[model samples]
Target: MSGLIALLDDVAAISKVAAASIDDVAGQAVKASAKAAGAVIDDAAVTPKYVNGFDASRELPIVMRIARGSIFNKVVILLPIALLLSAFAPWLISPLLMIGGAYLCFEGAEKVWHALNPGDGHDSEAHIQGEGGGVSLEESRVAGAVKTDFILSAEIMTIALSAIPVADPLWMKALILLVVAVLITAAVYGFVALVVKADDFGLGLARRGGGMAALGRGIVRFMPGFMKVLTIVGTAAMVWVGGNIVIHGMHELGMHQPYQWIKDTAAAAALAVPQVAGLVNWAVTAFFDGIFGIILGFILIPIATKVINPLIGALRGLFGKTEKAGH
Candidate 1:
């Protein structure tokens, strides 16, 4: 009887340890995931556009495919690479983070510029139809969405990797990143699925009897505005997060003048606000971040459209032209 009791006690103790570890993992995952909020929001905002033109039947599948690709990007590829890099060349993390931050700022600023200009040339897609042959069209749309998801996933994973606690073992870091990746992919795509199907849900409600039907029509009516709101929110988030990342990265790199200046200015503003100093401080910091982001993005715009675009086009042509010649 004594031996059995001891054995049971030991089992209970192990279970408690296991439970604690699980909680630790979950905590770490949430923290890491939060760091990628900008990218995650962009993913949600950007995905709906891809399904815009497609038949209703195709939307969910397309989102699923992309979500799967995003999972693979984070888990199979980015996770391992992040683990290795963290374990070995941790110094490179800041520079790489800065690059990601710059990319986000450029993207966010570009969106703002486009909204202001409303130039006819900016490419934004919403719906994807299966090619005339429904099957091929389906395949193509799925592949395209997956490719786009991969890019966003890369950003998310990098952000999460940067967010992990540096003192943790590589295994712990890897576990945290993996948990974050799975949870984020599920949340993002699940929300996307809901967004994509919303119109159908509304229409179904509009048709059915009772208060629910009226609710459905309202949903349909509301979605267009809702999408517009989402776009604006996503754009703002991108700029704020991107700017903050870049500024912090600069400080980490020992290029502290701009960051220090911004902090001092924000502090001064915060001091002026006697009642809500914290709010003022946050506002001042964000304002400078956004300003810096705009400046950097403006600098990048011309370069992207001119040098980068042409170089990319030329490289594509170089490879494709040869392949064509060979064929």
Candidate 2:
């Protein structure tokens, strides 16, 4: 009857609304994910090293375990933290983001410093290769990688949360962040899995002994160089994104001098090259951002190495003593 028709119409309207909300979530998720590209690239670039020297059979399994841990870090740990920040302490987001940005800058600059002065012996490659005596090497590597991923995931989630519109409903923000978490974790770790196994794939192709074999040999030869390039790119991205975030955050906090100076300088550079003005502007901006990041990172290096590291070691020692006493 008429009443049945009205009920059906109401249901249809609700369905339409739900569909629109889902679409919004998807769109926002993709946009937010793109905002965290620097961290994503670094994640992909950093992960493969953890599986290095492992048997081919173990590579994929290791990656899967790391990926699972990354998901847990993002979903179970960071997601709720992000939601709580959005709901309660929205004002703190900018400062926390700047802190993360400073970290990126410091990391990138330290790498540059090490590259320029290779005798430092502080490289992670050496640490990763050095055998730890207590636990299985594989377990130690996995634990280290998961710890690293937690930091990167915190950066990713925070960046994504900042990218979402503040006016959006809480549920909408949650949905967008959830989607971003799942998609980004899958993408980074999946690419890492491929990178880790590429050598084996190349070897298999070489064994076939044909035209395809040549391609496989090429892949095998190309992988090391490609990884180096990826690392360099990831490092640069971290510097750029981190520096940019700090600058923007400062601007938001009413310290606009640096941001304005950069903008003006980039505009001048763009005007000098009218044919590729946009490209010129971006290049100039990125250049200055990188420089700023390097400087800030250099400043932080001594503090981190001398102060923060020792403090952390002391705390860990204290906790170990406490636990033993309790036992």
lDDT of 1 by residue, 164-278 (tens): 7788777778888889999999999999999999999999988896889889989999999999999988887777777888899999888896899999998999888879999
Question: Mind giving the per-residue lDDT tens digits that candidate 2 earns over 1-327?
Answer: 999999999999999999999998999999999989888998998889998887778889889999999999999999999999999999999999999999999888888888899999676445555485434888888888998899999999999999999999998988898999999999999899889989999999999997899989999999999999999999999899899999999999999978999999999999999999999999999989988888888999899989998999999999999999999
List the candidate 2 regions with Cα displacement exceeding 4 Å: 124-127, 130-135, 272-275
Report the alpha-carbon TM-score of model 2 versus the true structure: 0.94
Clashing residue pair totals per candidate (backbone < 3 A): 8, 0
Off by over 4 Å in 1: 1-14, 120-133, 271-277, 321-327
lDDT scores in order: 0.83, 0.91
What lDDT is reached at residue 265 by model 1? 92
lDDT of candidate model 1 versus the reference: 0.83
